[model samples]
Target: MPTIVVDVMPKAELLDPQGKAVAGALSRTGHAAISSVRIGKRFELTVDGPVDDELRASVQQIADEILSNSVIEDVVNIDFGDAEPAADASTEA
Candidate 1:
């Protein structure tokens, strides 16, 4: 199985209220050195199949369709699994 990890964030063009809230709270708590903080989401998924181009596209589609809001959000990263399988299991080249 291949695992896909996604880091989603609000689009740079849009205003992020949650991020502003965090920044405000930080400044109030004496963290004035920090100017801003952008809030985002991370999602990890286990996909069953080889980590090929098709699988990568599918994972991207899933992220765009369900994991992120295209109107105001953007996907930052997608990482494939790195675990090595046991010798008994078949692997893709």
Candidate 2:
């Protein structure tokens, strides 16, 4: 099976009260290194076979139409499970 991972997060410019509250609680609990937190959603879709262009497009459409809100949220990342880490990417080698 092939899997698609979607991560959606609130826009940076928007204030996330839930995240703020969680951050404050963590700080109060002595986790001083935690400065902030932003809440988000993660969706994983497993298709029957290898992910192709058509599947990718369908997944993208599903993401845009049902998985996230475009008004105040952004799709931060989309990953095909079989993809290898890009050699030149700073986050992954």
Candidate 3:
């Protein structure tokens, strides 16, 4: 099986309330030296066939159109996760 990993995050201009709360909690709990935290989402898709160009493109489209919201979020990354050889990857957003 092949797996594609998608990572989505809120746009830089927007505030992430959950991340902020976690950061505050960490600071309060004495996990010092942390300045900020921004949380994001990750989606893993396991596929049935070998990874190919068409499959990759479809995944990219899905990531951009379905997995993330263009208004508030960006599809930050797509990892091919052992389905293909590692290379320098392009960020989708």
RMSD of each: 8.2, 4.7, 2.2
Local accuracy of candidate 3 as per-residue lDDT tens digits, 1-93: 877888889999999999999999999999999989999999999998988889888888898889988899987778987655435444544
lDDT of 1: 0.76
* lDDT, candidates in the order shown: 0.76, 0.78, 0.84
Q: Name the better of 1 and 2 by lDDT.
A: 2
Colliding pairs, model 1: none
- For all predicted structures, in order, the TM-scores are 0.76, 0.85, 0.87
Which candidate, 1 or 3, would have the higher TM-score against the true structure? 3
Task: Name the candidate, 2 or 3, with the larger TM-score value.
Answer: 3
lDDT of 1 by residue, 1-93 (tens): 656787788999888999999999999999999999999998989877678778777777877779988788877776666564223211122
Best by the lDDT measure = 3
Error of 1 at 17 (Å): 0.9
Worst 10 residues of 2 by lDDT: 84-93
Q: Give per-residue CA lDDT, model 2, range 1-93, as digits (tens).
A: 767788888989999999999999999999999999999999988789778779877777777768888888877777877656223211211
Model 3: number of backbone collisions: 0
Kindly provide the TM-score of model 2 when superposed on the true structure, using C-alpha atoms.
0.85
